[model samples]
Target: MAAKQAERQLVEIFGHAPRDHSSAARTFWQLNACPFIGKECTKFDHTRTICYGTCSVTNAEQEVVICPNRLYENNYEAIRKVGSDVFGDIPFMLFNEYVRIVASGNHQMDCLVALGHNSGKEVKISQLSMDWVIAHIRNQQLVEYVGIEVQSIDITGNYRDAWYAARDMRDSIPASGHGLNWANVHKRLIPQIIRKSLVYSKSLLVKNGLHFIVPEPVYQRFEAIIGANIPLVDRPGKEVIVVHTYDIGPRVEQGRMRRLVLNRELMFDLNEFSKRFISGPNLPPGIALDDKIRSILAVS
Candidate 1:
């Protein structure tokens, strides 16, 4: 017999599912809190009042991360992983905290400090912004830094009904035409990565290259869009861009979030990634477009 395919619906709300009835789950839902970032959920409804605390969702029986905050699980261990890989095994602190200590002349050098979206002032380069600017402090001076862009696939259609039903302790999640926005992976995300790579590649301070951190499935989709055979380095190197993919591991129990396991780290220079993007498999054929244009003209 064929196994039942999972319906596209809400799988996790504020890190756990609708079916979770534990006191901890209830408390998180009541408080509209996010365990990952250790604060109230950043996503909200249209009015910007109520928290829209959807974390992950079901797609083809697989739980996929939808919220970017969900990526901050395990105390931002993924960021730490990138720091260690690029700047060697060093301790990490929030960038703002580092600044405060530096002002007092008590800051330690040779440590990794991260300037994230919510961590005080943003560092912008020619109007482009990075999700996180990880810097290595040496001798109380800015030595080296890397730009990181973090993304979890966005969703199409509304899951508000399902979220409400889940929040109320419903037995079953309501169906709400929810689906993953896979198109955005190649359309917006990859292009943005390429553009940022170009900007960062020209800088002397950005020694480690720009990193794009995304969920495992999103990276798979990216490879499929652009031919998987494209040449890329397996280890971190002087490449202009690095792609880090992560998979969410199974939870030991309910009422707790899953662990994010680093799956793959692929590196590529600016020329390589941009070449793949321009001539990727997703691009339309020139002859086919010319024919469609002629047909439209003939109809007129």
Candidate 2:
């Protein structure tokens, strides 16, 4: 089949598993428990560190696949109206850059939005999602990752019910008393998704000796949490991979949106993990200077 041939070609090019082989090849997974209103997202930390939601399976593609919540995240309106088939209408080039980021295995937070499909391609939001997905695919070879723990109580085979566990995890979160930054908290979902991973992501958390910790300014709006990374132990393939969990939020901000987390220690305290993502005041991968931003804008 064409797909098989394409897979072989890609494997030859990158010496990696085919994109469809995530279940068998994935070593790194960045999963997110997002909000239902479509605005906010709660990133479970325990799942990131211990690989709590990790599972077992082979890399063989299944007969019936449930497309992740990604379809829902990209253009909720179009999907709500026309459904998955609508993607067929989107030009392949439109999804090309997105495919690049995912295959590369990392998310550049301060990325610029490029030109529309009409003009020459630029780094658009849609492209960003595709990029992270590709990254998940690329990181599948890391074998260092093992086990996943996020707030989830169910172990049902059906993906439809995964959110039930995720929701329970959300409920376990200690109450907070602060407003949230609309952009910082809400818009951060892409990176969260790009970084978090679990074998079985719950609407809440699933216990596996590891505690599923959540960051602050949290909210949940997603219906079914979709996993981006591939599963290794559950699969019968040999590959090397590792998941990098990052809490890139500022250590602290003085504003009404600041979350008044009742139990500060348990939550993903930003100050504690500040150094993990930021390297010695140097601008990390995706960030650019204000002048650069102005230049990009001018070019746009």
Candidate 3:
């Protein structure tokens, strides 16, 4: 009944015949991206049908837009499988561009954008083929763990605290301050301050390391601290925030893939207002209740 209602709502919004696709078994990429994929269960072309589900039900243009849910429930995958002829690169574009396309053309799209700190970061990737990250997370025996860096337990003063922060207020929160400037900060905000500190303690395998795609503010502060120590490592001439392209690049890709799967991936990272705009609790317009009407009719 719930599914039927969702379908009905979709039909009303789209003003067209809804697709009726289903998954045989869940898949990882399909799972996260399921919310966006709807019914075609056949192809990725939004113009022809709704491409929603794990397994393809037909040869006409089997599109599993979302990844398989088999990995686990609630794990979103941003995958789109069109016909073999459509087997080229996926069209990832800006939000405005997608909107423009929608306005100008008679086509439809399931666009995705991923942005966040390390905690909320999403990954993007093709199925099965590891551009190269699978080995690190799974191989415990072949690799030996290496250096562990102790996180600075202290934080600087004038910490950021905006349960409801304006742009002006958030602007000054991330200014440059020296190491663990504890005296300037307060007890109430200490936990949050320390939690935001750069000092981290995570075990990594030799020839392997963790890459955290932190928020821009965190990135800036990190640059402030580590930027000075960068030149000594290898590229002796430059003073910079040194990040190994090989170490962190793959992880970023993974996070991108994850966002694509979740259907929540935005074409651009939202600002404060945009975030609020998208995350509001408001419901879609309600239909006049027909207590006797079955939900299948909604999609039909």
Candidate 4:
């Protein structure tokens, strides 16, 4: 199913549905806060007058994370999972903290460190930046780092009406024209991943390849664009790009909100991805140019 809600309903507001109406929900809404990111919601409408804190939406009867920050739930478990996969079970500290530790002559080796906006520094490659850089530190030196990109689906239309309804503590959301921007999969996201993968593949410090963190639905669309038949690698290696997907699992009974559950981790090399890109999406089998011309003439 499309990530777009059939009725543009609000599945989550401030990380909980309007129907929740708990004290925490009320507090978060009143403060215009985002519990996931531990700050005020950054999304605003065209007027920038109010925070539109919708986090996810119902798609195919399941909640799909629409806001990237929502994936920042569970103390960024998704990112930590990737880090552990790349760097093993060592403790990880944000790069800035690691730097401070080094300054204090207490820097520890054989641990994982992350570099990003929150982690102090984000590395840029070929004028483009990955969301995070996770490095493995051994013997107080850089061993290797993995580049990561985090993405969530874009909404095509405003859900301000639903946001307002939710703000009023209503259980129902007004219908809006919002839809998921699936076209972005092939047009923007795929290209960016390809470019970043190319850059990472050539970098000496990047040995573990690039990684993409996306919602399961977005990852599904990605697989469709790249052709589902493409062979997936079993493990991360130099020049391999992995797509990590997460699902906002069904709300537990009487639970305030749904949980972001790690779903699939699919790995593929740049060579394989490029082949699918060059080939492009499949075309109809029975149509002919002459038949199409005749059909157009008939319609005219």
Error of 1 at 170 (Å): 1.5
In TM-score terms, candidate 4 sits at: 0.88
Q: What is the per-residue lDDT of model 2 for residues 181-220, given as tens digits with 9 covering 90 to 100?
A: 3333224542343233322122132121112222221222
What's model 4's lDDT at 99? Answer: 81
226 Cα displacement, candidate 1 (Å): 1.4
| Cα-based lDDT for every prediction | 0.79, 0.24, 0.23, 0.79
State the weakest 10-residue window (summed lDDT) of model 2: 6-15
Error of 4 at 178 (Å): 1.1
For candidate 1, report its TM-score: 0.89
When 2 and 3 are scored with TM-score, the better candidate is 3
Q: How do the residues 156-199 of candidate 3 rate in per-residue lDDT, one tens digit apiece?
A: 22212211121122332222121232232123222222322112
Candidate 1 vs candidate 2, TM-score winner = 1
Give per-candidate clash totals.
0, 62, 37, 0
Write down the lDDT that model 3 would get.
Answer: 0.23
Candidate numbers sorted by TM-score from highest down: 1, 4, 3, 2
The C-alpha stretches of model 3 lying farther than 4 A from their native spots are 1-205, 226-229, 232-300
Against the true structure, whose TM-score is highest?
A: 1
The C-alpha TM-scores of every prediction are: 0.89, 0.16, 0.19, 0.88
